[model samples]
Target: MEQLSNNYGEFAHFPEKVIQFGEGNFMRGFVDWQLQQMNKQGLFNGSAVVVQPISQGLGKMLKEQDYLYTVILEGLLDGKTVNTSEIISTVNRVLNPYEEWQEYLALAEDENLEIILSNTTEAGIAYDESDALNDTPPKSFPAKLTALLYKRYQLQKPGFTIIPCELIDRNGEKLLAIIQQYAEHWDLKADFKTWLTKENTFCCSLVDRIVPGYPRDRADELNEKHGYIDNLMVKAEPFMLWVIEGPQKIKEILPLQEAGLNVIVTDDMTPYRERKVHLLNGPHTAMVPLARLAGLETVEEVMLDADFSVFVDDLFARELIPMLDLPEAELAAYAEQIKERFKNPFVRHELSSIALNSVSKFQARLLPILLRFYDTKNSLPLGITAALAALIVSYLQEAGNDDAEVLALFAEAKELPTTEQVAFLLAQTKLWGQDLTEVAPLVDTVNDLVQKIHEVGTRAVIKEIHQQAE
Candidate 1:
């Protein structure tokens, strides 16, 4: 079999217009895949120059394959299973800044470079006070970006449409702030700071896709199937969404929507963020404890069981969706998509993995909806309340994964009376951001649910909730 490379077939070369940080599976499968779609449609006639964000990366392997790889998308689409593969050639080259610092900095001088994309993980966006501007390639992603931005500023080049795909809230804004801090710390001048702020468009983006990179398990079979030894083949889910919180002008620049891609360029991404949190993530967090307690190992396992499936459906239709301010139909459609994603055959999403730090997950994903549902309907959302009860019970049973402090608190709470335990957990303002006990009937409702869960098994309680909803 031929190695997956440009040598095997002719490939089009476009002007380098995007400097992407992080040459990981996610960028290749998600951002670069979308870019390839746009380029094929003549909407975005450019390729990305991938800069390895860290010292150790896939730069050598990517370069070996001529920066070409295949992305296999397997998942349900529109109520039907769709499996597709396409060779992504949107990456022009991969540069390791550690080895080729000068060449990496030279990319900043490219007159055509207009977009900056990154997914350096959530921790990659932090400010490291130790980073110096003079370093060949600064340690942190933000610092490296700051150095590159300073280089571009020196050349008086047009600033980039900086869109960071980090999972943090306000990712672009936070990246910009970190760069500005570096500017202040390094004394890069007020004029440079002005250019950084005014010339550049920092777009906070929300990206969703599951890229289980490098299918090593089936590599030999897939290599023979494709007739190519693809070292960088990435396996991803068919569903993808990129919501860029930016000005409308960015739409004209990228034009991904013209290429029939799932890209949303909005001025505010709060509603979209809320939709994802409430619909997709909230349900995942809420299901983890109950599902794990019921001996379900994976998300698909929970979704496959008839009663648990209906319980999750009602949790969405009756509880989570009503709290959102977006169009009911749009929310409903997204909820259905999430359901399909949960049941993805290719993905084995473990309940215990999702259960990690579930305290914070519950606080962020479900608490707002729980509060809003109560305020709007003037009644407790039984499904969510039950989930909360299950969470506490899981911790009490020593089945939860959380910070040591939180685990210790739950350990101590386990010895208290049922009502007192409920009250004690609810009153931990530091954990919940506010005293949940103040909400009338909340503590009592949760106490009742916890007691009921202890009496009946987790599966029985879920069946009861679904029956009541029906």
Candidate 2:
């Protein structure tokens, strides 16, 4: 018998009521997949209409499949390796506003639309001053949303709730405020603001899922067993979290908590938000650069590297762990879980993707550890600092095969006069948001280590950093 693309027949059908702004991996793997569980469990019956937020992307491809795509969830489930794929029929249509602008706006008048979910990346939620109300799609996500909300207000009162899944702090609330900024700038009517205030609700949400999308290389081998060519196959880490800061009414509307899934509906999801960013995401950013330079291709490889292995564990255990407010045991458990996640082996985390704005990433991830180390220990450890130094040198290099993609992505390296003046680049207030250079020993240490990276190869630097940590 011919194998099916995915196990689609097992899941139940639901009313298409959720308007998702992004037709991407995270939204499909995280939000739509979770809804499948809720729909299957008979708690919530809601499907989604995925909109292509950007002008370019998978909208055309998704439309070819009747908006039906396979989600292949891969990871350890209760100590057993479980990899499953099911065609998610929850998406009714994939609409591209750049082409189908009117139909995209028509969703605003959708009376049954209870949720406006989005994951348009970190920079997606911004103000584009020139974005006109009548543009095909506004310059920014918030502007487009503002226009849509205004359309909804004019149609009648509002019934939709917004749950932003963007990887930013207080995503829903931040996006809502940005929309309000658009409203104020454009001088939208008072009734619209009142409708925004009274009729509509923006619930701040924190979502966690490492969705390694479309195992392109492995799809053929994996398909031999399942018996179908599943091109839209998706993969994710075996964990998920959706923490929404909303009232009891939201609980009633979104019954995801009833499914025994990890859905936390609380008055404040701030702690959980901080917990995810500081613990899970922080390590990925901190490790990616140095690990990539050390000849490790994937996160799993980085975790398993004989030299960098202990260095990473020690870095997190000694430097990063103490910065967190959690108990030592709890922090250790989380760190161990992160290490295990890195060892997933299934997902291929490309170093170049994480290397975008890497200086910013280092500031966000490692700078906190550096500062806390000084405040508590009064001296920064050499190994972690050396990793940061290697990262900076990687970013600085103009010619190299490995870091070529990363270097290309950056807006031409214009700052800093010479390689010897690396510390001056680290001192940039625009990058770190504060003067991190003055934070004693860190500046000189990073500068010195960067010089060493310039002299010795990445492998040697990795060995030295590891030895220093030991």
Candidate 3:
């Protein structure tokens, strides 16, 4: 079969108006896919110039395919199985900043480059004090971005609509603050700092999609089906959402919504963020330890299990939905959507992968709801407490993946008596941001659940608690 490239068929080449960082599957499947739709519909006549954020990345592989690839979206939509594929031609080229540092910085001179998109992961947006402005591509993502923005400032080019898709809270604001710190550290003029503040529009965005990149298992079959070899083929679910918090004028800039895409350009995205974190991520975090203990490998497996599915449904409908401030009907609808997404057989979301840094995940995703549930109902949320117990037990068994300190703490806790171990884990102010033991009856309840889980196993405990709830 021929390699997937522009040589295979005629394709429109648009101006490189988007400078995107991170050329991973998520970007190609979500952002680039959306851009291709926009371009095809004549809403946006532009393509993205992808910058590989790290020294080693998919730059060479992407360039080999002429920056062209396919996105296969497969999942349940409205109770129907939908599988679709499209060749994405929205990527103009790939540039590795590590090798082409000068060329990377030169993109700042393009007046047509009005937007900047990034998904460098949560840790990608950090301030490295060691990074120097003169260094090739700098050391950190923020530093690289700072250097590029400085070049744009020098050229007096119109500032970009900088939208960061990093899964951090206030991502755009955090990124902008780091760039400001770099400006201060590098002794750039006050005027440049002012330009960074006034000229640039940083938007905090929330992106939701499950892009499992490069289907290695069925690569040969997919290649034959498409009549070409696509090294960068990404598999994702049919669902996609990009909620960008920016000024009203940004709608005129990107016009993503105008293209009939599932993009929401909002003035405030706090509610949307809450919806995703609590309804979607909260259950995901809560279920990982329990599901893994129940001998489940993937999310679909967990959803297929009779007991686990009911447990998940109860956790969402009974515990999580009531804690949210959104409309009850809307939250209920979203909960159903999340359940369907979890049941998607095409996406093999592993429990072990979600288990990483679960302590922090619980603290961020479920802890708030746990606290609110207790406050509102004056009783422990059984499912969340059960989940907490499972988390503690997972750590004790060394089944958790977390920071060295967290692991060490749990390792030490494992040597203590059961009650003391539970109490000790709960009292760690660093883990849950406060001594969770101090909450009335929380420690005793979690201890009971933890003991029950150990005696009966996760599935039995889940079944018992689910029956009690029903």
Candidate 4:
């Protein structure tokens, strides 16, 4: 096959209009993909400038490819396998802040740059008092953003509309509040806070898209299949959602609404937020252990398996769905859409990736439902308990897939030797922030399940759970 030009040919020209941070799969596949469509329709003729937030990243390689990459979208689109790829050209350039802080800050002054997008992870929004205003690039993401905003403030009265793509609640507002705290800590002028409150806008946003990214292993085969070579081909599911908590201005900026997508610009993001985390993410956390133990590796596999898929469906529509406050029919429809989304044909939402921050995820997504189930039945959810035990065990040893994200999250899990030890640990109230172990039959059951899982294997333990749940 003939090697194509580095720019991905004529498919690389979306006007340079967006300033982005953290060049990762989620941003490229979701945000840039949306912008790509907008550009094609002449609704948003905007290009993106991605900054490498951390020291090491693909920003250099992204620059090498002339900020042009492929977004291979695959998923169930109205009950059909929709697998397709388009070269995304919105990223006009990428900058490494560690190497070129001045250049990065300079680009922040761009008049055309109306949007600021970031996904530096959940812990990215943090306050570090040690991080000084004069630091080349402040230690925390919020600090770095404060510094950049200050530099921009020197020129104009802060016009850049900020949208933090981080998973934290009201991330944009949280980030803005942190920036203000930094300003006060440094004894910056009051006008800065006033400017933040009035002149600038920071909109809370919920971004949902599973971007598996960089099919390095499948590159050669995919390259041959496409009859073209692309070094930065990003793979992801077709199901995506971007809910921005803002007013009419957002519609004027993001032309996604015009494209007839699930992009919602609203004043209240609670419903959308709950729907995503509870309906979609909640089931994912609940299913991991059962699915993994049932000998299923990927989410799609679990959804496809007769027994396991039924397990997931029942958990979503029957157990978990009733816990949500939305209309029953609407919630059921959302639940179905979520299941189909999980069965993405292009990218696999690996059992491993969903396992990242599992404990935290349970607390946010399923803990409420567990509490509700306990209060109503006076009996605990054995399925949820089994999943929890699996998570705790996954942290204990490097026994599963070679997933780096899971390996990194191992430290965050509860520390215990046996299931009994795990029970004792949960009783502390310091870890889960509640004395869940003290509840009737909960702690002993957790310990017992943990022990059984360790003694046998994931499959045998899960089979028992299925029998008990039946």
**Off by more than 4 A, model 3:** 78-81, 128-138, 352-363, 378-382, 385-456, 467-470
lDDT over C-alpha atoms for residue 391 of model 2: 70
**Between candidates 3 and 4, the TM-score winner:** 4
Residue-by-residue lDDT tens digits, candidate 4, 1-470? 64434534566466567888888888888888898888888888888988887878888777766777788877776666877878778888888878888988897567788788998766567678899988888778888888877777777744788888877677888899999999998777787777776877899999888777777658898888777777878898777889999877889888799977789999999888878877787788888865766567788888788767766766775567776778999998888788777776566667866766565567667777788888887887776777777766666655343234344334444343443456555654433548787677877777788788878876676566667666
Candidate 3 achieves a global lDDT of 0.88
Better of 1 and 2 by lDDT: 1
The lDDT, on a scale of 0 to 1, for candidate 1 is: 0.86
lDDT by residue (tens digit), candidate 2, 1-470: 33342243444556778988898888888888887888888888889988888788787777665566778777775678877777777887788888888998898777888788898876566667888887878867888888888998888946578888876777787887888888888888987888897888898888887887877668778777556655566777767888998887877787888887888999988767766776777777767767776667777777777766776777777777777777789878877877777788777766655565565556555666677778888888555577677776676664333223234433244354555355665666655658767876777777677667668766677677666656
Cα displacement (angstroms), candidate 3, residue 464, comes to 4.1
The residue-level lDDT of candidate 1 at 418 comes to: 63
Tell how far residue 94 is off in model 2, in angstroms: 1.6
Whole-model Cα lDDT per candidate? 0.86, 0.73, 0.88, 0.76
Model 2: lDDT to the true structure: 0.73
* Model 3 C-alpha lDDT per residue in residues 1-470, reported as the tens digit of each score: 88998888988889999999999878898999999999998989999999998888998988898889999989987678888889999999989999999999999989999999998865577788999999997979999999999999998888989999977678899999999999999998898999997999999998888776777778899999999999889998988899999998887878889998888988899999889988888888888899888889878898998888989989998999998889999999999888889988888777776776788778878998999998999998898899999999888887466765678888889889876998998999767879997798998999898998889999998888888887
Poorest lDDT segment (10 consecutive residues) of candidate 4: 400-409
- TM-score, candidate number 2: 0.87
